[model samples]
Target: MTTNPERTIPPTTAGERAMLESWLDFHRETLARKCVGLDDKRLREASAPPSALTLLGLVRHMAEVERHWFRRVLAGEQEAGRIYYDEADKDGDFRVSESDTWEEAHATWQAEIARARENAAGRSLDDLSAGGHRDIESFNLRWIYVHMIEEYARHNGHADLIRERIDGATGF
Candidate 1:
């Protein structure tokens, strides 16, 4: 089994925000580490029939997710359009095409991550969303951080299985 080096979250950390950010970063690297050494074709391969998931698709979907939560909702950019979703096809992020290369997907995901960090920087965990859509008016920065960490954790589990299936690699 091949081993990939991943960023480790400190077992014990100071402050809630620091701990949350550290774990989120670790999970982000974990997903990227899963895709390491895979070519575009391999990254685009699905685990089994009927599921449209792929490492490339997950990367794209995460990019869309980061943009939605950090930029659109938390930062109050309601006019911003989704990075991958479409009214006609809501699952465009997961429905990646042959034309979507791993390079593009990974780069977009990285960019979104950077933007999310920038948006959250200097803001308190107690900071609330500037605005939100109907019904849900606002959310605290802490909620966004926790939600993102949870999202990444769930998706990283999928990534683990997918990576293992791809190359028999396990335990990064």
Candidate 2:
């Protein structure tokens, strides 16, 4: 029943961006690993108290968050909305149905990650900051990479406990 300590970031160097991406990859892989062997019932099981922090909902939510930050914001598509965002009901990504399958959630998240990787493929940290006539906040490509990595790291922490509680499994 011991909890792992937080990650200690190493000092940055010439390939700092690459290093950040590596960390991001590790966290993403850890998150995916957390959901491994989980069936639909377990994926949707709300083990956390008073809230539905199911793996399926976390998958869907991360997909939307990735899309919102990378596709919409980074690509200068202000009109694009978060997945399932509406005035009628905000946070729709979290509100899962009983019939929601793990496969569908996994697919959606993978696609979103693919799109984000594509958007960042040819560009360096320098290109990400080159905002010309864009209304969204301009950030260095380095910042975007760091921020996203941070987001994943934070969410992965939550995922760790949620996954463990569902089946008593832990560790990356």
Best by lDDT: 1
Q: Against the unseen true structure, what C-alpha lDDT does each candidate score?
A: 0.88, 0.73
Give the per-residue Cα lDDT of candidate 2 at 162. Answer: 88
User: Residue 45 deviation, candidate 2, in Å?
Assistant: 0.8
Q: Positional deviation of 165 in candidate 2, in angstroms?
A: 1.0
Model 1, range 1-172, lDDT digits (tens) per residue?
Answer: 1346468674594789889899889999899888888888889999877787898899999999999899998898877688888999899999877798987888889999999999999999989998775589899999999999999999999999888889998876
TM-score per model over all chains: 0.93, 0.82
Global CA lDDT computed for model 2: 0.73
lDDT, candidate 2, 39-143, per-residue tens:
888888886679877777777888887787677766766665677456687778877888988778878787888887877777777765433223655776677
Off by over 4 Å in 2: 1-14, 128-136
TM-score of 2: 0.82
Q: Name the 10 consecutive residues with the lowest summed lDDT in model 2.
A: 1-10
Cα RMSDs, all models: 2.3, 5.3
